[model samples]
Target: MTAILITGGARGIGRATAILAGARGWSVAINYVGNEAAAQETLEAVRAAGGQALALRGDVSVELDVLALFDAVQAAFGGLDGVVVNAGIVAPSMPLAEMELDRLRRMFEVNVLGAYLCARQAARVLSRDRGGRGGSIVLVSSAAARLGSPFEFVDYAGSKAALDTLAIGLSKELAGGGVRVNAVRPGLIETELHASGGEPRRAQRLGAGTPMRRPGRPEEVAEAIVWLLSEAASYTTGAILDVAGGR
Candidate 1:
């Protein structure tokens, strides 16, 4: 059976992907920083959807924690077949000039650094030269990366842009090793991430302006992500797919 590890798998796009993967009979290892309750709920939901589940608590920003997360997945699932670099954070809307050092530091630390850490570990374990079966690595970026998210969290936009570059470079780096790397850029998704950014209805408010005239659902993005993780995208690599509504 396919075995996958998804960082921040407790909620939003991560949670939706876990449940969908479950429905496909894949073994899923979910990593969450806090909210064990949400993780446990997702665990049950995955099982209910007919897949095995494991909830691991870890902070992606911490190297030790990230190491343990991969280790735990290996122990629990025997080996990993895919990884979703999805754990990230967003702060309140603000111009670049007004942004505080601590906020910028934390933003990059978790978004960029944490993503690199996860991608690094994924490469180590998924590379064929590393004595493991090759697999897929999917990074969850954002449309903000392209839009620049002007006047609202440019730091977050910059951080996500890093993921886009990571996906491109890492895909080529691992292509000969039998591994595939790609990223998804979701736009105006209705999720708790916006509330965390201090704009609870940000998606809904701005979604109307998109060509699709609506915000995307987590499940919608999950479909694209899970496809990249599946054999359907067997020959696809170094691709950045936009799940945004043509914004």
Candidate 2:
């Protein structure tokens, strides 16, 4: 059976992907920083969907936590087949000038640094030269990367742009090693992420402006992400897929 690890798997797109992986009968390792309750709930849902599940607690921004997370997955599953680097955060709307130093640091730390750490470990474990089977690494970036998020979240946008570059560069670096690297950019998704950004209805509010006339569902993005992690995308590498509804 395919074994996968999804960071920030307790909620949002991560949770959706974990449940979907479960339905496909894959062994899933769900990592969360806090909210064990939600993580356990997701864990139960995955098992209910017929997948072997493990709930791990870790803050992606911390190197020790990232290492422990990968180690735990290796210990439990014996090996890993795929990884979804989906843990990220967003702050309230603000112009670049109004953004505080601490906010910028936190944004880059979690979104960029955390992603790089995970990608690095993924390469180490999934490379054919490392004596392990090759696998996939799907980074969950944002449409904001290209859109620039303007007056709203330029910092977040910049951070996501880093992931896009990482996906492109790392894909080539690992292509010969049998590891496929890709990314999914989701736009205006309906999730608790907006509330944390201090705009509870941001998606619903701005979604009407998109070509699709509505915000995307978490499951919609999950489909694209899971596909990137599966053999169906075996020949697809270094691809940055946009899951936005033509926004």
Q: What TM-score would each prediction reach against the true structure?
A: 0.99, 0.99
Instruction: Report the lDDT tens digits of candidate 1 across residue range 58-131.
Output: 99999999999999999999999999999999999989999999999999999999999999999999999898
| Whole-model lDDT per candidate | 0.97, 0.96
Candidate 2 residue 188 Cα shift, in angstroms, is 0.7
The candidate 1 region of ten consecutive residues with least summed lDDT is 126-135
Tens-place lDDT per residue, model 2, 149-179, is 9889999999999999999999999999999
Reference-based lDDT, residue 203, model 2? 98
Best by lDDT: 1
